[model samples]
Target chain A: DTAVSQTPKYLVTQMGNDKSIKCEQNLGHDTMYWYKQDSKKFLKIMFSYNNKELIINETVPNRFSPKSPDKAHLNLHINSLELGDSAVYFCASSQQKTTTQETQYFGPGTRLLVL
Target chain B: DQQVKQNSPSLSVQEGRISILNCDYTNSMFDYFLWYKKYPAEGPTFLISISSIKDKNEDGRFTVFLNKSAKHLSLHIVPSQPGDSAVYFCAADDTGRRALTFGSGTRLQVQP
Candidate 1:
């Protein structure tokens, strides 16, 4: 079984369009996170939620919003998609509330291409 | 500015040999460090980790060494096989932080 899964492994869209990427973790983790990997292979955290509570919020664009309906689901919605938004988005989950003891499990990334 | 850094972008190693990947961090508050491996079109998978209090951690063929004084860490893989080829990421997190800070990444290719 997949511990964490993401919908739409590949996404190709036009500019000014809105899109959403869904994520679910079956590991019963309390924390979930959204990360973006750029073309340069730099992985950066965009948002983090613990038990459906917003926790870590990086300096991401306001157009990108992350919503967690429950502890197992976290979705990312991007408005007015721009060409610079083309990258791989990954969803990750960890068991405990702290990062010190929890090892994060990630989903197969969603490659987003904004044309 | 990036707090974590992986100076080498790529490394090539022969099968049955050893592969060493290095990482450095500038944050003093970081208490835990981890190594993650990622194949193409996939997210990173946790490999090993080390706490600031300890200097070394080993898991079968993979070993991670931490030098708290220099704020540097290294991952050593012995008898590397072709399946070991992937991008390795170094991540660090502090006690209060819920998210980890990641280095750019280092790609390793093990030739068979």
Candidate 2:
């Protein structure tokens, strides 16, 4: 069974289209994160949510937003998508309770193609 | 600026040999370091980790060495098998933020 899962394993869209990627974790984790892996294979964190609350927001553009309806789910919506935004998006989850040793679990990435 | 760096884009090793992957970081606040393995079209899976307080950690044939003073770390796999082939990413855990900063992954190919 997959502990973390993401929808739309592959997405092909044109520029200026708005799209959403949904993420869910069945590992009963309290923290969830969204990361983008660019063409260079560099992975960077975009946002983090703790118990359905926004905890960390990187220098990502405002057009990108993360919604956490609950601790088990975190969805990313991109508005006015650009060609530069075409990349693999990964969703991850971890259990954190003041411990510095928690490892993150990641979902199979969604490869978005901006045509 | 990139905080974490994995200079090598790829590495190749023969079976039953040693494979060493190196990573360097500029952020001194990172208290924990981890290695993740990723195959094509799949998400990364955690392989091993080392705390800043400790210099080394090992499990099975995989071992991670951390050098806080040098701000460098390396993952060593002895008797590398073809099954161990994958893209290896070096990540650092931001102490208070609880977020990980990952480096550009290095693809490791263990030839049979």
Candidate 3:
């Protein structure tokens, strides 16, 4: 069984269009996070949710919104996607809301291409 | 600016030999350090980790050494095999922070 899974492994879209990436974790974790790996191969955290509560909000633009309907699901919705948004997005989860002691499990990334 | 850094982007080693990956950090608030391995088109998988209180942690052929004084850490893999080839990431986190600061990454290739 997949501990964490992401839908639509590959996404190709046009600029100014909108897209959404969904993530689900079966590890029964209470914390979930979204990270983006840019062209430079830098993995940075964009948002984090703990038991459906927003916790970590990075300096990401307002166009990108993250919603967590339940503790097991976290979805990222990108509005007005730009060429610069072409990158790989990953979802992760941990047993606890904090990472000081637990390891975070990650899902297969979603490769997005904005044309 | 990136708080965590992996200066070496790639490394190659012969099978049955050892592979050492280095990482450095500039943040003092970080209390835990972790190593993650990622295959192509996949997310990173947790490999090993070390706490600031300890200087060394070993699990089988994989060992992680941390030097808090220099703000540096290294991962050593012994008798590396072809299956060990992958991109490794170094991550750090603070006590209360929910996110982990990651280094760019170091790709390791073990030739058989």
Per-model RMSD to reference: 1.2, 0.9, 1.1
With candidate 3 superimposed using the best TM-score fit, by how many Å does residue A52's alpha carbon deviate from the native? Answer: 0.5
lDDT of 3 at A16: 100
> Model 1: number of clashes?
0
* Residue pairs with backbone atoms closer than 3 Å in model 1 (clashes): none
Tell me the DockQ of each model, to 2 decimals.
Answer: 0.77, 0.86, 0.82
Off by over 4 Å in 2: none
- Candidate 3 stretches with Cα past 4 Å from truth are A97-100
At residue B67, what lDDT does model 2 achieve?
92
**Leading candidate by lDDT:** 2
User: lDDT of candidate 3?
Assistant: 0.95
The interface RMSD values of the models, given in order, are 1.3, 0.9, 1.1
Q: Number of clashing residue pairs in every model?
A: 0, 0, 0
> What C-alpha lDDT do the candidate models reach, one value each?
0.93, 0.96, 0.95
> How accurate locally is residue B34 in candidate 1, as Cα lDDT from 0 to 100?
93
Ten-residue stretch with the least lDDT total in model 3 chain A: A95-104
Per residue, candidate 2 scores C-alpha lDDT tens digits across A1-115 of 8899999999999999999999999999999999999998889999999999999999899999999999999999999999999999999999977865789999999999999
The ten-residue window of minimal lDDT in model 3 chain B covers B92-101
Query: What's the true lDDT of residue B61 in model 3?
Result: 90
